[model samples]
Target: MDTEKYVPGISVDSNGHPSEIGIEITPEAFKNLETDNSKTVPPDGETIVVPLQLKATELTPFDHIGLNWNPHGHEPAGVFDVPHFDIHFYMISAEEQLAIPAWSPETDAAFNNYPPIGYMPADYFTPPGPATAEPQMGKHWLPGNLGAYLPFSKIMIYGSYNGKFIFVEPMITLDYLLSDVDFSANYSQPEHFEKAGNYPTKYNIYHDAVSGNTYVTLSDFVARN
Candidate 1:
């Protein structure tokens, strides 16, 4: 967790271009911040580092931030910060799974579903600043809030390999990914999403097993009127 000893590794820019400077991280270090919930443990070897890019105007820099996907407009909780636009890739090997005591022939199917490499966007929202508010009466009703504080994107690859999350140094920018797109695009519009046959509840990146590629889709995170 001490980034002081971390070194730079191979990384890619937001456009998927290769770069030489990436922040290297170990599984032990990653576990300090994230858990192996999917249980896709990595093997013992040279740990790979993930790269992140910061906004030019951002005064402070952070390797990672918790994303607050508050689709229902409830009270916010935990430390959340806007994510950096770019993410880096990390790879896993089959030997690591073999090293685990729980390794079994039946587990091969699970491992096959995971990609050998993955990339998670650095973007997230910063904790809200303190603000006073008046209490509402029991009979008062409020309309749904449908705006994103910041652009959110994250990708978890399946293994063809996985580990703890490694949030590292800057590499690419978000603008590079959506290059040439009209600035008028509105992803936060609930009505617009419905017209397009999409739900505006919760948007996320999904991986296609047949195509070996990732795509984004909008679905309900809560009941929508």
Candidate 2:
């Protein structure tokens, strides 16, 4: 059916309407993981633990706006730690964030080998825990697919102080996403990022919408104004 919902991971119109993409990814290529699929995209469910230590990197354009702009919403910027240099990305729920301790350089190297903070294979997905007791979830152990949304609404990154500077490659899906996820809801005309606050007007020329979630190199952002 034809509709005008905002799909996260997809770009949006100036009015926040979701733009259509040219390609499609069916179940053949993209797995529709139930709480119990062999691939276990999110093995547990609501909680997928990132294996790393992190320090707070400046909250990009969003930080400039206000971390709690939503009054009570997820922070778009992930935390980073200078000691360990690990990054924690995609932390949408507060529960997930509270699960781990602040980043520590000493733990960065061996934390992966310990339980409660062990690393799972990208394919070894698990929700926060085996199940959630939240009334919203009913009696299922998996997350309540209450709406047509993914497990997490935002993405974040946290890394130890010295592990590496390689950013987590963005994991984008050709599938649909929620409206709030598609656009920088907190961003307005002047507040939007100017590709690191520098560049020419033409370099900032953006399409009505974009094609992916990962950051595209803004060679244009560096152009002289």
Candidate 3:
């Protein structure tokens, strides 16, 4: 019997419509985890413990945002230390983010060891450049899905690397359609961000409802004028 196929699940739409999708889990994958874990798992199915010493030396982006915005104002930026933050990314499909393959020792050995790609220091964010200029950064994690009208709406599990979990939550609302120029200007000025008196401390993830593709950015909050 094929263990991967499960009953279809329903995802509700904004207008109260329900759509069916197969949210599946292979029985053996979890049952035999120790023998067939992916590259992400360390030897004992335990994550490698990054040292507390490193936390004293470097403050992650989430650390900075929380320190600056935390309700109690208890922690100073770059002062208190943490191991990880719960960061979620919106993805177009489960395969796009993590493609599970046929279990094999060979494939397990090839798990990617690339340091989390697309990280930029707080100092690199500048006045937005021309509309045609290359974006300031690359793929990254965020505090949440961070956009509206996300067609896929599937949230990827949180991830951490090198003792850092970046986070940026735009205060912008998604009530209106976004134009190319308007989108660019939002990145340039980011009124909501300015009003909040915080820098774009993390990044954003957006899904193209039409094309069904997912994208990441440090700017472009789909908010009001």
> Please, what are the lDDT tens digits per residue for candidate 3 over residues 98-149?
3323224443322222123333232223121121111111123322322332
- Write one digit per residue (lDDT tens) for candidate 2, span 43-147: 322332222112111111111000110111221223110111111132223342334343345433322321222221122221332121111111111113323
* Candidate 3 residue 106 C-alpha distance from true site, Å: 24
Top candidate when judged by TM-score against the true structure: 2
Write the residue-wise lDDT of candidate 1 on 130-170 in tens digits.
11110110000111221332222222211112122222211
Candidate 2: worst-modelled 10 consecutive residues by lDDT: 60-69
Evaluate residue 220 in candidate 2 and report its C-alpha lDDT on the 0 to 100 scale: 16
Q: Is candidate 2 or candidate 3 better by TM-score?
A: 2
- Backbone Cα, N, C clashes tallied per candidate: 21, 41, 0
Worst 10 residues of 3 by lDDT: 65-74
Task: Report residue 84 deviation for candidate 3 (angstroms).
Answer: 3.3
The Cα local distance difference test for each model comes to 0.24, 0.22, 0.24
Model 2 regions more than 4 Å off:
1-27, 37-152, 158-163, 169-225
